[model samples]
Target: MSMQITLRRARPSDAEAFERMMNRPEVHAGLMQLPYTTADFWRARLAEPGGPAVAELHLVAEVGGEMAGSAGEDPVGPAVRRRHAMMLGISVAPEWQRRGVGSALMAALCEYADRWLGVLRLELTVYVDNAPAIALYRKYGFEHEGTHRAYALRDGVYVDAHAMARLHPNPPRPSPG
Candidate 1:
């Protein structure tokens, strides 16, 4: 039997599940997140208002009413100059990896960025040793820009990362006035 995967805007009610996924050893190892984050932190963040001004998006993936994964994109900064770009992050449950959850989340994010937000650039960084994640980003058209040596500290040791980005394949043109 195959399970149907669904994607939707993340809700405050998902805080507990989000917290659990983020704290898992297999999950957080590849991510930049620090373990032991509280549910309240997720709830408060998810409860915040988001729209064009904020240019922030958080999406949750569900299979049979259970959380499978989550992904999000946020403007690199608050400055108007950076509005055309956003940084992306994603995490999938251990059991759901390689089961199309990541692809579904990436498709939704790309659709929103390219079509709705008019975003010109999307960026992400993955640890060098994470081959699966690197492959996923590459499949989404993210090209490696450079290597950031000693980029982050995970489990008490620094690790190198590859900075990757994807530009809007078909940017819309402004009408001549």
Candidate 2:
């Protein structure tokens, strides 16, 4: 039998469950101290600087009505210069890893970018040791832009991350008849 999964935009109310999903050991190990992030951290990230918050679009994959996985696109900035790009993050629940949930969320995000955001490209950074994630990014057409050596200190040790980007394929223009 197959797992029943559904994808939808994430909301502030889903905060607690999302935090729980992030606590799995494989997730904590692979992501490097991720489970250490407090629930308040996620709350702040999902919101803005004021008492209210900045609005951002994030997606979650729900399996059997539980928060199973998540993916999000964080716009670089409102500066006209930076509007063309957005950063991405993805996490699949431990039980759902290697299943179709991650791929489905990725596909849906790409579609949203193409149809709604007029996005010229999508980008992300993946740590060098996370082979599965690197494979997934490559499979979805993201190319390695470069490696930021010693980019982050994970568990007191530095870890490098590879920057990647996927540009929207341009459609051919019509020739003068």
- lDDT (CA) per prediction: 0.94, 0.78
For 47-159, candidate 2 gives per-residue lDDT tens digits of 64422122246888998998878987777776878777878788888888788888888888877776666677788988999998889888888999999999887777889
Model 1, span 1-177: residue lDDT tens: 787999999999999999999999999999999899989999998999876677789999999998999999998997878888999999999999999999999999999999899999999999999998899999989999999999999999999999999999999898899
- Candidate 1 Cα errors over 4 Å, as ranges: 175-177
Extract clashing residue pairs from model 1.
Answer: none
Report the backbone clash tally of model 2. Answer: 2
Q: Residue 108 in model 1: shift from native, Å?
A: 0.4
Worst 10 residues of 2 by lDDT: 47-56
lDDT of 2: 0.78
Q: Which candidate should be chosen as best, given TM-score against the real structure?
A: 1
